[model samples]
Target: MQLSGCIALVTGGGSGLGAATARHFAASGANVAVLDFNAEGANAVADEIGGLALQADVSDEAAVSAAFGKAITHFGSAPRIAVSCAGVGMAARIVGREGKLSFDVFEKTLRVNLFGTYNVMSHAAILMAELDPLADGERGVIINTASVAWQDGQLGQAAYAASKGAIASMCLPAARELAQSGIRVMAIAPGLFHTPMMEGLPEEVTAKITANIPFPARLGEAREFAMLAEQIVENPFLNGTTIRLDGAVRLPTR
Candidate 1:
């Protein structure tokens, strides 16, 4: 579906990829809603883009439902585009030192990354199903964020990898199920991007990380990710898959 004149909601819009996407959607003529757990950050981005700001923990079902309701009330319609980017990247080995189990870390990672994406997508699809279809009977599109670590997960990434892996694995089935409702589902698996997570790394450490990437041999820009999201929204046939935005880099085991 075309982005112009559409209503778009982006979770985790307070910073990083989501922030960039919110701005891009607004620039593309879509009425955007910026949702984040960080209320202040959400407000700042929304103010900058002239879009609505919503605060909620994506993993909280009631909070997410309420956020979507508020967005609908403010925009006078449900979002035609919903992007799920709110997630945490906590890492831990399944069996850490001293026989400490990482169950808590695992549970939290899945709750925020996997369950959170599912919550947003479910709500978005429901609302989209009620909307009038656009060209090709398209009602809306949902984009989710996954990580290259899903497949290239290094040591100390069991929790992170499993959460992201579930997202990647859900793409096709979700698209198939939502197809009947004229809603598309897709995911983006980004590799080593220049997000807030990478901000505090030492220069030498950063260099070592980038050395694995081919070609540009640097971190992917947030805008580049936004560009791909736009491309997916405009291309209806690009559903039911996870597109890797990594610079052709397969991560190594640490």
Candidate 2:
């Protein structure tokens, strides 16, 4: 469906890929809602785009539901487009140098990444189903964020990989279930991108990471990701699949 005159909600919209997507949707004439656990960041981005700001922990069902409700109250209805970009990264081997990997870390990642995506998608789909379908009987579209690690997880990526893999693996079932309601579900498995998640690395480490890309040999930009999100929302046939936005790069086990 066209973005113009629609409402779009983006999790983690305060910065990085989420921020770029929020901006892109706003530019396309959609009313945007910037949702993030970081209240200041969310508000800043919302102010810049003339959109609404919502603060909540995506992993919490009640919090996420309330956030959606607030967004609906502010924007007048559920968003036509919902993008799940709220996630965290942790690097730890199943058995670390000290001992076995901490169960708490592993569980935390899964809760935030996999369960969090589920939380938003479920709530968004519920609201979208209540809306009238567009020309092709399309009510809305959901785009989730995955990672290349899901497919080719390197050493020390057990938790991160499993969480992302859950997202990638759910695409087919979610799309099939939502199809009857005229809502499409899709996921994007991004390669390395320049986001705050990577900001803590040294300059040379960052450079080395991008140098591995096959062709572009550079980190993917957030706007590039936003472009694909727009395409997914506008294209009705692209459903029930996870698109890899990586530039043909399969990371080797480190």
Candidate 3:
């Protein structure tokens, strides 16, 4: 789809991958909405890109609905491109030295990563369906973020892996259902990237993770993720699939 003059909504647009995508979209002439739980961060990014910043929690239906409403109020229409990038990661073995993982921890991860994506996508699709179709009867595109850990998780990533795996597993069915409405759905399962999730790790641990990347031998950049999002939006035929942006790196079982 042509991005020029299009309206785009990016959840988790306050930081990391979401922020990068928001900036890219704005640079491409799209009117962008930056939505995040961190209102300050969202506002900062929005100011930089001349877009609207909405405070919202993707897991909270009311908050997400309100934010979308705000975006429509400000932009004069529903966003044609909606990217669900709001998620969290939790590392814990289902059964380890700590014994059984806390149910709360597991549930939180699933709620934010899996349900949150669904929440935003559902609302976005509803709005997109109401909009007039573009040149090729295309209503809009939805992009979701998954992780390579969903497929090749190492030790202590049960919650994170399961949440991401759910996203990857749902892409095709969701895309198929939305196809009738001219709405394309796709997912990106990213490997190690330079995001806040990795920033919390110790230096040595981060370096070890980077060493696993066979080619570039480093962490993926947020811009790389944004580039793929742009491509998925532009390539109409690329639907109902999950693309792995890991630089050919697959994690080993530890």
Candidate 4:
């Protein structure tokens, strides 16, 4: 899985983890495509890295298709490596002061987090299957972003946790199914990180969350997540599993 000259597609590549991964991939000699709903951010990243920028909402099939088509046209081929980082975070209790969270809220989270990942992974795999297998008959790799909340969801995290849980759960099955095509599927379940997700929260809440991490006693860097993505892409044996990038933190129910 040498990254040099590899065409990589990263959804949500405008900011946070996705952006970091795109930068790292480009630095590692990969021709990157920065796909994001934020057209400005995507273009900025693309310009910085001398790569392609595509705008699309990952949950929209038509948009995803268009984005890929643009990438193919620009790169002269489909991307073989895809990192799905497009997702949203939400907080709503199943039964709370709001008199039960709205169904729309729950469904939205699932749509963007779980369905979005599936959408990109499926498209990426289909495109990869057309590529001639690299060394060891490997066609490509897909890395999905999950969250530690999938395993230990706190209060008000029913919807978010469910979405992330599904993302993690499907990794193995996808890997198993795609193996015959020489494409590997893996997931990353991140703990508290310095992404916009956390930055958008109140300072007090952020502190309380950071206090729980056992080591480093601080927030996880976006680059750390990107590093693991690189490792997963380079290590052929690493497949069909979700790696927790939480710095040994285990989130407790709030």
Q: How much is 24 displaced in model 2, in angstroms?
A: 0.8
What TM-score, over all chains together, does every model reach?
0.99, 0.98, 0.97, 0.97
What would the per-residue lDDT of candidate 2 be over residues 11-46, giving only the tens digit for each residue? 999999999999999999999999999999999999
Tens-place lDDT digits, model 3, residues 22-123: 999899889999999899989999999999999988999998999999999999999999998998877777876757656787899999999999999999
Full-model lDDT for every candidate: 0.95, 0.94, 0.93, 0.93
**For candidate 1, lDDT tens digit of each residue in 106-174?**
999999999999999999999999999986899999999999998999999999999999999999999
Best by lDDT: 1
* Model 2 pairs in collision: none
Q: Tell me the tens digit of each residue's lDDT in model 4 across 1-254.
A: 98899999999999999999999999999999999999999999999999999999999988898888899999999998999998888787787685865678799999998888899998899999999998699999999999999999988888999999999999999999999999999999999999987898898998888899899999999999999999999999999999998879987768
Candidate 2, residue 86: how far the Cα is off, in Å: 0.2
List clashing residue pairs in candidate 1. Answer: none
Give lDDT for model 2.
0.94
lDDT of residue 34 for candidate 3: 96
- lDDT agreement of model 1 with the native: 0.95
Please give the RMSD to the true structure for each candidate, in Å.
0.7, 0.9, 1.1, 1.1
